[model samples]
Target: METILFFIIVGIISTIFGKSKRTQGQSPKKPIKVSGMEDIRTLFKELKNEVSLPAAPIKSEQKVEVLQKSNRTLEQEYNQVRKESESSRKALAASRLQREKMKEQTIEVSKDECEPSISMEPNAQTLVNGIIWAEILGEPRSKKPYFPKRG
Candidate 1:
């Protein structure tokens, strides 16, 4: 039993020391070179070329001419709008003046029509006669009294 226990302990210590020596004696693994690196670099170069390429350039004179044409058109449009606004304003003022004239004419015509004419005759004479007739005859049996019609 004692010899068996001593052998077991010696075996465990020998395994631990053997593993340390094996690890220390071995060399570290070198990094593997990838074959696809050249393809990636070429693709990056193509992207850089496409990005760095310049667009077709415009001449300074052509740019100036384009700007001048646009400015002229804008000025013409502004003038057209200004003329239209001025004409509309004139039409509005004319219409307002005509409306005021019509209003004044209507006021004058109404004054002439509404004025009471001076006359020596009394307008209530017929009413007084109607009252006298009603008192003499009292109320008639009909809805309307039998009074003589006058034009």
Candidate 2:
């Protein structure tokens, strides 16, 4: 708003001076002098300085090439990470299979160990018969009761 006011004031002053100068019979080729000459000059100088200053710098080709290289490296890293995860998954599956096989072997060994022996010893029957006969006879009448051992 202030810049617009300055331009309007300068324009009004220049027009009034221009009309007065025309009445003086002065040469029309000469530049018209106004009371606000210094302000206008300063405004033009500031505008020239702003125009001379560079705007945003343009991106060079080298910067774009560097970004492309970094993108490729990132892609390689992503593929490596994927491969590592897949290998670890396979290793876990193999270990699980091995654990299951170990469990099956352990179960088989335990079953074998738990089975009772089927072979009989010759004295097992004789010992059983003697215990039965002795219980039937009650207490022996004599201290030395003879009992024959049979094969």
Which structure among the candidates has the greatest TM-score? 1
| lDDT comparing candidate 2 with the true structure | 0.88
Which segments of candidate 2 are over 4 A away from where they belong? 1-60, 122-151
What does candidate 2's lDDT look like per residue over 1-151, in tens digits? 9999999999999999989988899777878778579889999999998888756654788679989999999999999999999999999999999999999999999999999655566487877976999887877656555874566
Error of 1 at 76 (Å): 0.7
Backbone clash pairs for candidate 2 read none
Q: On residues 1-151, what C-alpha lDDT tens digit does candidate 1 reach at each position?
A: 9999999999999999988987886535644347578788889999998788746666899899999999999999999999999999999999999999999999999999999766677579766976989877986657565895687
RMSD of each: 30.2, 30.0
- Where is model 2 poorest over a 10-residue stretch in terms of lDDT? 141-150
Q: Could you estimate the TM-score for every candidate?
A: 0.45, 0.41
Off by over 4 Å in 1: 1-55, 121-151
